[model samples]
Target: MPRYLISFEKGAMDHIPEEDFPEVGKTSHAVIQEAKDAGVFLFGGGLRYDDGDVEHAVVGTDGVVTDGPYPESKELIGGVMIVDVPTREAALEWAAKIAVACRCAQDIRKFMYDPDLIE
Candidate 1:
């Protein structure tokens, strides 16, 4: 089976509120369980807004480490899910289901397993 990254887009942030994102939360959990039941879930979770970790760090040829999202975007990666599926179509199907549950658009991209590195 092929692996895919099913990202819950940033637009979904609009639905979040302190009042209790019960609906969204419920659906998210359901989706996770569904993925587990389908035997596709690998590992996934929501992204944090900020942390004490180095937001930006760099390593020269001398050897260094860096932090922060390589390339930043106005919308952050809200959450993620890794699943093993047979095809992109199948992943898209699952993404669509998640979109309905979360009431937000989802970005589903197939993971590249390049061997020869010929793109």
Candidate 2:
């Protein structure tokens, strides 16, 4: 089985007004429920939807802690869903559902496995 990560940016929905967030939330949650019912849902969660340090933690290799969101992008990670499926096509299908529900672009990435961890 292959695990896929489906993630989106927070500001990607800036075109959508804040008033419509509830509806978007409902739609996305529905997709998560569907994934759960299909037994492919591993884990999923939404970011704090803020640009503050409270929502994100950055730890350096030296164990130094930085307070703030990721500096690489102005937009933060809105949400992420992880699924384990049989093929890339299945993962893409799920990504499409999420993209439509969130009304935002989604990045679907394959997860590399640790051979030693596989029993």
Candidate 3:
């Protein structure tokens, strides 16, 4: 099995009305539950960047920490889900369901295999 990362970039859902967030949350959670029941979900969560209170730090090779994301990043991940499945098609299927639920396009990428990581 391989793990695929399904994520949506920040601001992707900005067009959605604030009052609809609860419904969005409900639909997204339902999709998450479906994935969990299918035994494919590994972990998922939304990032907290809208609050302005979020602390950003970047650690350098010199062991010094600097503020903020990489200087080149123009966007941030809004939410992400990891699913371990047997094939890319299965991952795409899940991503499609998630996209519908979250009302945002999803970006999917397969994780490279590592011997030390649990399969």
Best by TM-score: 3
Off by over 4 Å in 3: none
lDDT of 2 by residue, 1-119 (tens): 88999999876777988899999999999999999999999999887745643766678899998766668636568789999999999999999999999998899999889778643
For residues 11-85, write the lDDT of model 3, one tens digit per residue. 899989999999999999999999999999999999887577644677889999777776965678889999999
Q: Assess each prediction's global lDDT (C-alpha) against the native.
A: 0.75, 0.87, 0.92
lDDT of 1 by residue, 2-118 (tens): 788888754476756756578778987898899899898888887765676554455658786555444543456677888789999989988887777776778887877876652
The candidate that wins on lDDT is 3
* Per-model tally of clashing residue pairs: 3, 0, 0
Deviation from native of the Cα of residue 74 in model 3, angstroms: 5.1
| TM-score, every prediction | 0.72, 0.84, 0.91
In model 2, the runs with Cα more than 4 Å from the true position are 51-53, 69-75, 116-119
What pairs collide in candidate 3? Answer: none
* Decoy 1 TM-score against native: 0.72
